[model samples]
Target: MATHLDLEEQEQLDQIKHFWNKWGTLITTVLVIVLGGFAAWNGYQYWQNRQGMQASALGSAVEAAVNSGDKARIDQAFGDLRSNYGGTLQAAHAGLLVAKAASDKGQMDDAKAALTWVADNASDDGLKATARIRLAAVLLGSQSYDEALKQLDAKMPTEFDAVVADHQGDIYLAKGDKAKAIEAYRTAYQKTAPGVEYRNVISVKLNALGEDVK
Candidate 1:
């Protein structure tokens, strides 16, 4: 009986290892994000007043350019922020705004560039994860399936788990890999909290694949 139980335990361990190998460190990272909340992304209380004011000014310039509908101006303003205030929340905020403007103008490359910088340089994991998720969406729209998946490869805040898996499902589905798509959607559905509207969205995706949301 002892030998049989040991075999069963080993099998379970192997199954767990297989899941870990597939998902990398996200499972562990998810736990940390929940316990810690990785709260720094909420604000930049440590910045000196002058530095904060300067960043805010540069952020305003980026917004003006976006409002002007001038891509060149947007580029120039965003360039100034990232060059001089790259580490500030204002810079990260500008990146997101620039990406939206770029996407609206159908400048996929520009959108990717802005989002990539935020993903690579944002001060906190939650913000970086936001960039990665947006970058993946842009890549998916461009039909760069592999590249999109790469953006989501890193461990992120637990809050982003559902979004990451949903993006993966879209990428896999775009590649016509129904099996992988379904698996990714299932992961998304399970991770999403009950009664969240987004969880219902994942359920719809799974249902389209002939899979129950259970």
Candidate 2:
């Protein structure tokens, strides 16, 4: 009976060895792939956190330069932010601020350049739309009427419908196309939500044009 039990145990050991011999490499490969994926995910999370911190710090530098009213410093900090962290929200915000400062200083070319960058590269749809409209305004100021109209002609999100129509109205008005301006203004007023002060402003514009919001 003891010899029989010993033989049975030896048989079980041999079965296990045979199974391992058949599948050991496959099992190891599977484990390596799963573990590698988990490690890669962890590394990505760590890198994203580090990037967010760095971008936040750079954004603070931009805000400081803007506050000091130092164009050179503002330009430097903004350039750094754009070059190093352009994918971050902070960089987009800095672009808008820089454009506004440049515009206010009558640096229309610089303003248009900054706004164009933001309009092209901002991660958020809303920011892109804002930048485009602002760029159109700068073009309109420079009497680049065709370019201004082109900027307004790009596809935009529904949330920008009213504001974009309003901008189109402004462009048409500038072009001495009062009939088109009135039509655009009517579209803007119609799209504007109830209870917004912007709607009232559009109403005033329509009134000035000898047309009421339909």
lDDT leader: 2
The TM-score, computed over Cα atoms with residue i paired to residue i, of candidate 1 is 0.76
Best by TM-score: 2
Candidate 2 per-residue lDDT, tens place, 1-214, comes to 9999999999999999999999999999999999999999999999999988999998899889988989889889899989999988889888998899889889998899999999899898889999999999999998898899899889889999999899999999999999999999999999998899999999999999998565
RMSD to true structure for each model, in Å: 21.1, 1.6
User: Which regions of candidate 1 are displaced past 4 Å?
Assistant: 1-47
Candidate 2 TM-score, C-alpha based: 0.93
Per-model clash counts, in order, read: 0, 0
Q: Give each model's whole-structure lDDT.
A: 0.90, 0.92
lDDT of 1 at 60: 98
- For all predicted structures, in order, the TM-scores are 0.76, 0.93
RMSD versus native structure for model 2: 1.6
Candidate 1 on 43-70: residue-level lDDT in tens?
3444556678999999999999999998
